[model samples]
Target: MSPQPQAAVGAPLSRVDGRLKVTGKALYAAEHDVKGALHAVIVDASVGRGRIASIDTRAALAQPGVLKVIHHGNAPKLPYRDNPASNNPPDGRRLRVFQDDQVLFHGQPVAVVVATTLEAAQHGASLVKVEYDERKPSTDLEKAKADKPTTYARGNAEAGLRNAPVRMDLTYRTARNHHNAMELHATIARWDGNKLTVWDKTQWVVGTQTELSTVFGVPMDSVRVISPFVGGGFGSGLRCWPHVVVAALVARELKRPVKLVLNRRQQYFGTGFRPAYEYRLRLGSDRRGRLAAMVQELDAETSSYEKFTENVMYAGQMMYSMPNVSQAYRTVPLDVNTPIYMRGPGFATASYVIESAMDELAAKLGIDPIELRRRNEPSEDESTNLPFSTRRLRECYTTGAREFGWNQRRAKPRSRREGDWLIGMGMAAGVYDTARMPAQAHVRLDADGTAVVDAAASDMGPGTYTSQTQVAADALGLTMRTVAFRLGDSLFPPTPPHGGSMTMASVGSAVLDGCNRVRQQAIKLAVEDRESPLYGAEARDVIVRGGRLHLNSEPARGETYQRLLTRNKRSHLEALGSFAGPAAKERHSFYAYNATFAEVAVDAALGLVRIRRVLGVYDAGRIISPKLADSQAIGGMVGGIGHALLEHTVTDHRDGRIVNANLADYLVPVNADVPDLKAIYLDGEDPNADPLGVKGLAELVMIGVAPAIANAVFNATGRRVRELPITAEALL
Candidate 1:
């Protein structure tokens, strides 16, 4: 670590770029003013499983302003070198568009029409006619069958379940969820000879660069993915989807830049989504509320061409101290588009069922819900057999119970009521594995004493730009105003995907690296230069404050950064900081924990559960920016509300097509749905986690939120609904 300036790291500061967002000056992927960029529209497959039988581009090619049509028969064959690093595509076979006529699933990209205008391309896509020799598609998870299952076993669960005094066997279902970011998925591709420049909505620029390089068979240096502003990506933008490739293909064929943007309807089917899951759990516990054994069977939706599996059973193996455990997670590859990661991924789905089961056991045994969970908290991650870097779940439970007034919750259902509403409170524990990835950042101190920090990161509505600015301000000897942070472009230092709650811990460490390097360089220059005030001072004894380097004992005797740079005839100083990852240690367990509480008002007659208030208290290491962290917590809690009450992607099931593919049909949480929400971050930092002592918070905020609310609804009505979107119909 390099020496840095003194500024508050945890103080609540306003977003640095809030003005740009409110004024609409921030350039999203489609908003980038690319001149003369031809518009392109993609035509998706109407059938779930089929193959094109004949060529029918005559009508589309004849449309006014329609430049050309690219399909499987006439499109270029891309060189897709298997780069497993950024290709988080869990399924081995990547989706290759326009290279073959074999249709893998419904809504697969079949053809792309390029035109002089967007409207022309849109109309041209509608004009394209196709006939397919269709086959009966297996879109139903229960009906579709596969080979042997992936299994995990510890001690004999059969023997343990036999010896247990009490047991429960139940099944839970969660519907598919779309990302539905405010800004739709868009791509603008421009090719200059062999070099390609693209404006894309991506979470990871370096990852996107790697994937595009593999797709185009070009060197990594030849491709540049620039996206300075992203509206939001729960996990939808993690991979390079097919539309990005179509835009690039159209640009290369026409010898002109091409821009393709998916509308709200296209967004539902075009981008990836959270796979619907069917989980069956058989849990055995003693009369004392101690877990004895567990057996879990997990099945999720995937595409026919690939295998997509979520860590849906990860939390079950490690959360509680169970002696015997057996788990099997498998994917039912259906004739539907492949599912990508959502906000919480596997854990969110798993948490809902596991927590619900725990609540059930508490009810059966006539014990308090919190007391039941308190008896099962484990000391370490039993599955990995490795100590966590820092686990604070106990503190979360202790503090959250007091703050949310959990002690007042009634142990029996329908114990409280308000008019026609059955009022109740519920709380649940949350956990997320703090993922870390390698990232880099560049820092420079100009002669004017203002520092510039550049990294290939993004805000994504979580305030990455603002939080990183705070980190830089503290790392360098400057106020928030003197330090400027820039991100969302590949030209800056490379970074990983912005999801997974790892951005803060990974990217903040990188910014700390660069700022510390810059600060050290200034200190060395000032100490060695005879004209400096602290020329003879030891480097260790000198510290920076408010952009000035001074001695520890004598604060008044200092050298301004501008003075040192001007006298040395030095224009500026630069440094690059990076974090490779921490060495694995054995002493302490490491996991960020949260305690979420929800209050619901269920109408006894109508069976409609309306959330009135919600609160989340998190024990994530150190908070770099309080405001940004609060925003993350609130956003996550709001997403949780959506998970519990709304946000369901309904599939027609008749023809294996998503029936509600638009925002109007598919529901998300509206302003009226979310009323009072609160996020609280515990004041603490773990030295072992990273140089910045900050664990990521994006994913942690949304974990177990749905389960918490569902449990609360049960406390209100004594109705245990296993399926998600616990809609009015289910309650009724």
Candidate 2:
């Protein structure tokens, strides 16, 4: 069939839901007005570990407006049937809310008070008393024992290292980080007899539905999750947290709607965080800066109950060409909550260590960093021995160096200075695997030349709503204003979780398929109809544009969809589209690549670092929306700045409690902290990646940011801190 006119797909369109959001019409999870809903406040455990000895709820129950106070002593035992489909850890049982007196971690929810108003719930929760058999907690990564290591070895790394002339061993540490999205993690649950519905802040409504069903031992269809709008979610909302279950359980037991919203302090322990990591690297390279061997040993923090892991070792194996490589990744189980993916996740942390090490190697060999990296560029992914589908990292480096004025940088550290400030420029390369999963979308084109597409996806502050609309608009041959895209309802077509940077490639492909099918149905109807214009024309020769079907060779001979559908007495045409992801045995390695450059000014006397500028050149495949892509890039750079210099979740290891839980103590990059920032995308497409040709930009943009800044700090100050949040004390 002839292709539809490509008008809206690449256009720089604003968010379709922008006006609704700015005008206060868009309802977030907590904003949904459920009638007669009670408020619930969770009471946290004071101790870090050990079982609860006694609980007293007399004061809470006596409080005015307090409907019920539920705790382990009085709460019913839930079925919590196995649900392998959800995002829970595969090897361990999930924490069941209010199931037992066991205290797994500091700030564990001991009880919840439900009342008519939020104020009453808060007051009642404060009045509740609890005593615990406290035990010393093990929260420090250095002090805790690690689980069995997940080992990988390709060649004789020790022998290769022994034969090489140049050898270096280094250790790097990254502090824990919180998601800290503007919207609090919240849920409002309502039950009608056996059926349950919840308005939640989540990245995957279907995942939440499945989890709720399994927890209550009910049919999946009986639980419906609705989340129309989300302020932000940097992977924290990917799974159903314990607080969501608490809300649902309260609603069901009390036979009334219940709402629970975690406050800022509770957010630190209530949800997941980016775990701290200690990575030690031993490398052997020739005098010419070509790597010969590498050995990587990493220890990361996780909860004692569930083991959490990320792609921390991929960079060591595939980022460069090495004949011998060995890796051992061990998780140090501590008295803390399980960790989740935050922004770039494991790749970001790995890039910092790998990129910083590359800079150090370049300094040792008197070689340019970019030239050294070029010399070690791999012809294929050595881990899988698969040719890359589209590896434009070289192009990204060239373009970024040219754009960021890399030639102006001085090779010597602390050589360029402006009075009390030291100036330096640095760059780092980044990569993220192109991830895709099976997804489905539903489409309906009405007789009025308008179309509506539905998918069980989410827009977690990345403009998913607008980008998907663009795909649908162009594929259906309709104007952007005429196409309506709806998501975040479990009743819609199933879609994969809205994280992993796969939403556009997976969900957008499904939407394109649905719209294309609907358009073809209209074309077939118009051509076969005896009373229509150009009735005998071949359907293959017809193309749609502006809601009108016409012969590709003779555009003037056409009929509007409105007239054709009105005459046929049809209300609308519908179709369901799907994407079956990649093949079982993938033949090619696919990944998005980027080169991030940073310029910084460090106060020589005060030891303060100020970012002068940042530039990111990405080789992520086809960009569906340029404006949205810029937004993602800028947000990522800001987040990276925080990761490098400001953000750190400080834990009081004595009690396993996060001391800097609130925004006042935990710092982030603000407008004043961020200077000039820019993003450039290479114009290309990878057919093997996905139907949309997008290799996923959100995560790639963030991967190299922290390392770039860290390298710049080293060049400016000639000091290697080897830890995140390069503080003034470390520099001084």
Compute the lDDT of residue 128 as modeled in candidate 2: 92
Q: What digit string (tens of lDDT, one per residue) describes model 1 on residues 95-193?
A: 888888888777888999999999999999999998898886788878888535789888999889988999999999988899998888999999999
lDDT tens readout by residue for model 2, 1-732? 677788988788899999999999999999999999999999998888999999999999999999999999999999999888875453677889899999999999999999999999999999999999999999999999999999989899999999999999999999999999999999999999999999999999999999999999999999999999988999999989999999999999899999999999999999999899999989999999999999999999999998999888888889999999999999999999888889997899999999999989998999999999999999999999999999988999999999999999999999999999999888999998888999999999999999999999999999989999999988988899999999999999999999889999999999989998998899889989999885999999998889888899999999998999999999999999999988899999989999999999999999999999999999999999999999999999999999999999999988888999999999999999999999999998888988889899998888999889988988898887789989988888
Give the residue spans of candidate 2 off by over 4 A. Answer: 88-90
As for candidate 2, its clashing pairs are none
Backbone clashes in candidate 1 total: 8
The TM-score values for the models, in the order shown, are 0.98, 0.99
The lDDT per prediction is 0.86, 0.93
Model 2 misses residue 645 by how many Å? 0.6
Model 2 gets an lDDT of 0.93
